[model samples]
Target: MLSTFILSQTKFDDVNELVKAGEFTKASKLIDEKVKTMNLLHEEIFQLQFEKERLERIRKDFNKTADDILKYARKYYPNATESDLRKWEDDGSLEYKIIDGKKWYFARAASNLFRINKEAKKQKELIDGFKKDPLDVFLESYTPKVLDESANAQEKLVKPVTFRLNYTVTVEPNAVPNGEVIRCWLPFPREGHERQQNIKLLGINSDEYVIASNDNLQRTIYFEKVAQKDQPTVFNIVLEVTNYSEVNFIEPTQIKPYNKNSGLYKTFTSERAPHIVFTDKIKNLSKEIVGEEKNPYLIAKKIFTWISTNIPWAGAREYSTIENISEYCLTRKHGDCGIKTLLFMTLCRYNGIPAKWQSGWMLHPGEVNLHDWCEIYLEGYGWVPVDQSFGMVDSEKEDEKYFFLGSIDPYHLIINDDYSTPIFPAKIFPRSETVDFQRGELEWRGGNLYFDKWDYHMEVEYIEPK
Candidate 1:
């Protein structure tokens, strides 16, 4: 309503009228010129902020009816009952918001809990945890399908890949003011991130793009385009990166735990709130998982095994939407890569093991996925990769199972070592990805365009080994 009123006072209405008249190119050009001429005034900018704040206040004050909560829960867990959900809320496994003296929930919280949290309350057999019908897989696989024919074969299984890929982000036309300067931040690969190296900027489509400073925790190639009527604004980046297979063999005898007084140990070991905090439930679970274990390596192994056994891989809501991600996964029982990783990190940190976030994309010949995993800083052994969601499933390859616990194959394209860190040069509006920067962010002077208002496409082609 506020935006509708505000639109009445701006050139947007004129462009919109042109669009209705089938004068898109003219509307596009006219609005482009006007944006350069009349740029949004302070009052217009304030309205955008005001509207955003107003919506937030509504979100804060909204309360979910019992049926409302159950509605979301049943989508994920078909058999979930209101009583069962209330039991979760009663036990403090599910967190809720308060509005008008009633209990409410962030919808994602309700959904995540119904789907995954129930498992934390139940006990499962050891053999039931592994993935069924283990597929013969990637270079990341312990045994490769074409290891002998592959060039870059340093080990029995070799998977080396390079690619000149184009990633595109397009915002729905008319979502923002046509005259406003649309700003877009597309995900970019750092010069050398993990096994992904030789980052080269082949091109970007916009007239000017600022590849953020390399040190920015969540780096992006920022682009500015003048919004025009009737056509979606497009942003693109073409780049190349290569991944080499990585493996680590854990030798427990040589591991030395970190000193308690050191700052390095303190940083990762201590609790980080909103996601990685140690609640009573997490503390209790940590104690249970580490009942007789004193060694950091053994402690991590136990927690890793517990999570891999308990939490099965399932699609998850955006990290930004969840209040306590790790706890959500802990109580809900299933999560995607990121949710499981956060739960693993929080549990490890609670038990004096240091862990942190790492995510980007994973690529193999026919597959590419937006992925998240973690790195644990073990004494002497340094930082080791762990993917709890994809752990060793079958007992036959116990050594291979341990590979993901202490090491990761080199298929990772890590973009952020830390989650929720600010993008460089900063964004004037609230970030679309407040907790994690993966698909990237976009905004203009009037307001922000959310993921729903845009689409992101990632295309990859392997630079075959010579």
Candidate 2:
């Protein structure tokens, strides 16, 4: 699919405004009228259909009512008052929208409240006995080991850890009519990356499947299965990969100036619209945060530190719903992994730093989850990993605080070196995920089957080093 299209601009704008105003019914009608009367390009029609799909996706994300959120909050704060809820809402910690005069909360708003609000977290720990997340616990123990190993080793890469991963996507029973072909794109490990190597697909449940070529940035294993009545259609792949820890030892003095004419520098630093545009807000914020920093690494560090300190991580709405993720994150004052990473990339790019997206699964022992981070290119040092959402480490040593800035743990399962890139075999409809592809995507002759229509699960086993 084409990355962009030129629609009937003024009419499309009206539809967009209607969708934004929660006038989806009107928006749908207008879209149909345009298709019938306007000489629209196929791409424009495709875009319009997605605009309709966007409305449905938004409905799903913002399904909760005020009462629902309050009830959920009362789980930890049984005496939680309406005023407290209102306060959280004002702070943007509890995501909600005043849709057509009725307040609708993001589906994860109740769960994310504690994550974004410090007092709510304290209350939860006191009342619900909340503990540190397994992922945080694992990172505490694992990061230090990698840093120590990298500090001593002559080579930049250290502590190669191999894992056997089983990933499955199940389309809910009758998601489509029985015997209809369900097309699936499962997230498979990317090839030809130095840090991620020895990728071997052990097996797949389906007898026939096409593993996307190494060049597909968003690499996927495509499968086709017929839906069965009352039974979920399942697709899975078991694969073994050796993921290595990357520790690029850098010296401030040795950092080289970016070769301005280089294509890598040009492509990444320039604005990619809909998300990475260098808006006035971004330009000003970058100036405020960077503050006359000339060194490329230091400039990146400044942007990273500012986001780490200011933009607290919160659960994000679906990527497709938001027109501009980076700007949304800035306005909301919080975002999840990919949201923060997008903001990070935008700021870095605005400041002439070459930054791009990297994501997959972070398989840290028992703490496996869909994750996103980015890599920034330095002239002499090559590209370095930066997990902006992980934030700064609580340590006096600069290296410890900056470990993720230049290094990555072996727990990473690098699936996409970049975001919003093509899926091999070329999907016919808009992807279930317009941005990052982690959970996998499905569709049939009917159309795209969204996240609500299916479920995804990943299981991992550690292989002992020889």
Candidate 3:
């Protein structure tokens, strides 16, 4: 069960069983029956109510039918056949579920199939004419330059790019009563990092808004607005930040053994249940991959290389619905940026390497979107950026091939230093995004508003170096 489940009673255990077995209808019925009979605590009642919402979210993610998948796949593969679809499903390349005697593919399955399957991507490129991910193309040109600059300058951070962004969130009309107050928490740039600095708030839409302190692990800019009849509620913030590409040229000879008594090492290496647990599977895989490696940096490199080569990136479902994100990614054999990053962090922690989450947005030109990566601590080197999703690049040079293992590019907008941390002013309801906080959160006195109730957009203007 997901850590979100608040109740520990025996009946709640039964509900958990039903949910695990995909008996959502039965689970909902059981919840209703228990609610009518049991003297549940307020938190218990809230958890029970949310179980239904969780089921609804699952349905939304797994709503596409077999026919729909076929129609979508044919857009790329005109000769796509049912046999090919079944092969993909069997191999876990195309995720689907058997729901009530019918097949329901993941909403993003069609597009993800091309991403995870090499042959599918080849076919699509043949039809669409040699396509490449813009971000990868961008990296190919700048990675060598950033490494060279860092080496020559004798500095970790180099190649700074300042950006001006107008981030906006709009709630659909009549999402709540016209007179009701809506609370929103927009993603704010995290302060006090070597690579991400000079954060400036240029302007904001709301006259009265609370900007959380720099120390809030998952930071935000909170606002409250009264809904208007037949009009959408909107919140906006304009900010400027200078991001730098970090290239830590790690020398294995200078690396020191970790002090076991240190708090930072202990806290980050220890298990955090539900997400970063050191399960049997995780421990076994760590041993298989990390064999006799004693150097912390070397151990981390092995983990990063294994994951990048094994787990192909794919679109993921909402984080709130997942029980264990790392385990889920490991089981599915594919995941998005956040999913791969979690698995990487978990493996590093299991090997006694301190790893922590870092995410906000990727400010790549014409390709801005929410993204995730992590940081790992070395005794002598301190914490360095590691982007498992970016992984190993195709280059003969050591610096460029393992760029993300100990370094990162300049396009990051880090909004959260740690995962699953509380927002400032305290949210009355559970956050829509339990893990990462990039999209922004909204709620009313009535209840928390899920992603479907509103939309968010970011417009980035690169502040060219003067």
User: Model-by-model lDDT, in order?
Assistant: 0.68, 0.85, 0.87
Better of 1 and 3 by TM-score: 3
Candidate 3 local lDDT, 1-466, one digit each (tens): 2322322223368888877777778888888898889999876777787777777777888999778888989988778889989999888789877654557888999999988888898888888898667778888888999988988899878989999999999999999998999999999998898888889999998789899999998899999899999999999999999999888899877899999788998999988867888888898999999999999999999999999999988899988778788888888988889999999999999989999999999988878899999999998999998999889887888789899998998898999999888888788777788788899989999988999999999999998687
Ranking by TM-score: 3, 2, 1
Report RMSD for candidate 3.
2.2
Question: lDDT (0-100) at residue 294 of candidate 1?
Answer: 83
Pairs in steric clash, model 1: 116-332, 116-333, 116-334, 117-331, 117-332, 117-333, 162-463, 246-410
Candidate 2 per-residue C-alpha lDDT over 176-231 given as tens digits, one digit per residue, 9 for 90 to 100: 99889999999989988788899999989889999988888888999899999999
Q: List model 1 lDDT by residue over 1-466, tens digit each.
A: 1221211123367755654453434555655566466667765544434333333433543345667766765554557677876787776545555433445665455544534454642322232353433232543354332323232444522456777788988888887777778888888876544566788889888677788887887778887888799889888889888775555556676789678798877998888767888999898998888998888888888988888787866656555446578888877667888888998999888888888888887664555778888889888877888877676645455565566786555556777778877786678766666667778888888766777789988888778688
Error of 1 at 86 (Å): 9.7
Taking all chains together, the TM-score of candidate 2 against the true structure is 0.95
Can you give the TM-score per candidate against the true fold? 0.72, 0.95, 0.95
**Order of the predicted models by lDDT, top scorer first:** 3, 2, 1
Q: Who is ahead in lDDT, 2 or 3?
A: 3
Q: What ranges in model 1 sit over 4 Å off?
A: 1-158, 192-194
Best by lDDT: 3
Model 3: what TM-score?
Answer: 0.95
